[model samples]
Target: MDHVVVEPDSSSFSRVARALDDEASGEQWRAELATDLHAALELGVATVRGSLMGMATGGLDDGHEPLRQAVSASVESQVRMSGRGAGARIRARKITLRNFVNAPKRLNSRRGWRHPVHGDTETWVTQIGAPGWFDDPLRRLHARLHSAAARALDNRARRIARRG
Candidate 1:
């Protein structure tokens, strides 16, 4: 797999971090970053799981269970680390892992729930409900995380381009 290296001098990191922080207050930013990181981590896990399922079903004929397992484990480990970030720290530690695991299931179950603003393409799942400090804050945080990650990745690409 090819990984993009971000130049230390690039403003993209700070820009993304600042944008995230500005979009939400300092406290909210932290929470959203954590939530987003958790979501990204789960996405990575789901990709691994999908790959494993594919291999099991003979969709991938190369017999890559070990590879898939390694990838999944790595993602899970990262998820655990990211879960310790700002927003996550605010929530109870014991439930963090459970929430991370359940996030995907919740998303999957809400496939039919259309987004009010964006129609069917943009949907949200509030499996844990929307009344608590943790719930809405985490949702917003996850959204910010997703945007920041994309920005970071784009910044990395731009850096690589400059180098090349």
Candidate 2:
């Protein structure tokens, strides 16, 4: 029999090995951590939504449409928070939203592998602050959304483990 040894370099095989290590140490602990992290994230999201909604309502006068416009403007401002000029603003909004939805799905699908606990946590934390903000409210909202999404994903992972 011939044996071939290969080094891990961001490959699926190494990923499986890492997961096995996590499971061997304690799957339950991992699951609990994931749950806690998820809850924190969800809380962040709610906070952001609340802040945005409050801002909209507080600014609204006799016209109800202004509230809707305010919400839209707030979100648009966050999306366009980056980029060079007008064109960059338009592109940034589309790209940011698209990535926001897609990135979570991609991370969630990785439940098949074992991830480093701290590594995953750091990723979520970094995501919350990924977008720089001139407006405090928008910055908070972005951070909250990121945290919430991450928490939701951790919850899903826990559910999956429970099923198995």
Q: State which candidate has the highest lDDT.
A: 1
Kindly list the per-residue Cα lDDT of model 2 for residues 1-164, writing each as its tens digit. 59988775666656665665565357575555555544544444344444444431222244334432333343321121125741111111222231233322222232323323332544422222212222444355565656654665566566545443
Q: How accurate is candidate 2 locally (lDDT)?
A: 0.39
**Candidate 2 displacement at residue 159 in angstroms:** 0.6
Residue 128, model 1: Cα distance from true site in angstroms? 40
What are the Cα lDDT values of the candidates? Answer: 0.40, 0.39
Model 1, position 8, has a per-residue lDDT of 62
In Å, residue 156's CA in model 2 sits off its true spot by 0.5
| Model 1 global lDDT (CA atoms, 0 to 1) | 0.40
Pairs that clash in candidate 1? 31-87, 32-141
Q: Assess candidate 2 and give its TM-score to the true structure.
A: 0.25
